[model samples]
Target: MSKQADSSICAYAYCSHEQTGYEKHFFITPASLLQHVQKLDELGYFLEDITCMQVKEGFLLTYHFNRWEKPGRLALRVLVVEEDKTIDSISSIYPGALWHERECYDFFGIVFKNHPSLIPLLLPPEMEERPLLKSSEKLRDLYELLPGCEQVLHAPRDEEFGQFIKECSQKGK
Candidate 1:
């Protein structure tokens, strides 16, 4: 895992393709998402999927991409707080995202701002409750499920993740 390659995308740390099956994984802000995604489109990556997960911190939206020639996956992750369940729509860049985004909306109640026809895809229109949301007690921090600053089969403590992030940030200086 390494720091972000450029400023356009905010990267803390990412797992290697050999280790995680992703060529690169980046943690970015919703503000910078479209610009970076446009770069990926220009680089010939096709949208594979967009998945949403509820965590202790908030909602984690991961967008997966890959190129036919390269044959490796890449991910751009953004954290949206439970308070503001919104982010810009990438359907303009990748038309296929319409379905994935809709599924996220149907299942998680995530509002994809500027998404054209942001309606239920799998669930019925009258279903007011999101099926995937867990109770607060069941929600786990992202570190428990994902690699924080590095990969480990076991979940790392929050302090470990915080220290790792700090150490990695110092390296950039």
Candidate 2:
């Protein structure tokens, strides 16, 4: 999907830091990943790390970022399916992503396009399979791993999520 469409289809979901380990969880697309990350960069958020997991839908890449002034972390997620296992390199915005990206590549076999060096960081160059990837039957949806999302992932009302976000925003203030 186009970046605009990907973003327009979903709204940001707020999570409690004390209860969920993060303040906000955003579900974005690979096409829109750079811009969302660029905005965070402009706001002085630092890239903590990049992690990846195999999900029933696809490979879910979670980019974790934080700021010294902020009290909690924020996660930006992009789902990459088997047909296209690539994402834009964030090393340009946050140089630290260079190493983290390499690690993700090493295990999950994700291709970070335009990366300075896409070589393996931990695995052997001859490794044929992505060690972190599991068989199809073992994969699970991203929502299952997310706290509170399980309660609402199947909820028929957007109002419920909107209200949760509003409450979280107010509590943060």
Candidate 3:
């Protein structure tokens, strides 16, 4: 696990020799999202796709980047709080992200800050409700959804997750 000077940007132990998928998955704070994506761009990672999932914690935005020459993919996951469904745009670093971001916005209602234009990509302008938002009762734990897979909270540090877990534990009291 590696981290940048900014504690918000952290790389976890998602990668392993036996793993056949992405090389790494980094948890990034909303503030460091742009910088992290920019660094990946500088390292020659091409934007492959951007996927959003409505999780119990919030909205999980995963930016998939790959290098053609090296042939590996790295995903940067950013958790946007439900109340603040926004994150910095990586369109400046990877122009292709523009469309992907727009699509995410259209479906997840996640605003891409400073995006050239954040109009809906797949939905009509008249649409107001984001169809992707799931009800709390239907929301499932990450582990339950993906059996046998490791689950890592998208917090900057494990301690932060610990705090959140503690708070959640006390909520029923």
Q: Each candidate's root-mean-square deviation in Å?
A: 8.8, 8.4, 11.2
User: Mind giving the per-residue lDDT tens digits that candidate 2 earns over 14-129?
Assistant: 45444546766666656777867776776668998999998886788889887797556777777788788999999998999999999999998899999999998988898878
lDDT of 1 by residue, 1-173 (tens): 33433333222334454445665566676777887788677667899999999998889899998778746677777788889999999999999999999999999999998898998899999999999999999998777676343332122233333454355356542
Candidates arranged by lDDT, highest first: 1, 2, 3
Better of 1 and 3 by lDDT: 1
At residue 91, what lDDT does model 3 achieve? Answer: 87
Q: Write down the worst ten-residue block by lDDT for model 2.
A: 1-10
Per-model TM against the reference: 0.77, 0.77, 0.75
Please identify which of the two predictions, 1 or 2, would achieve the higher lDDT against the true structure.
1
Q: How many pairs of residues collide in each model?
A: 0, 0, 0
Q: List the residue pairs that clash in candidate 2.
A: none
Which regions of candidate 3 are displaced past 4 Å? 1-11, 14-20, 143-173
For model 3, which pairs clash?
none
Q: Tens-digit lDDT track for model 3 on 83-119?
A: 9988888888888989999999998899988999999
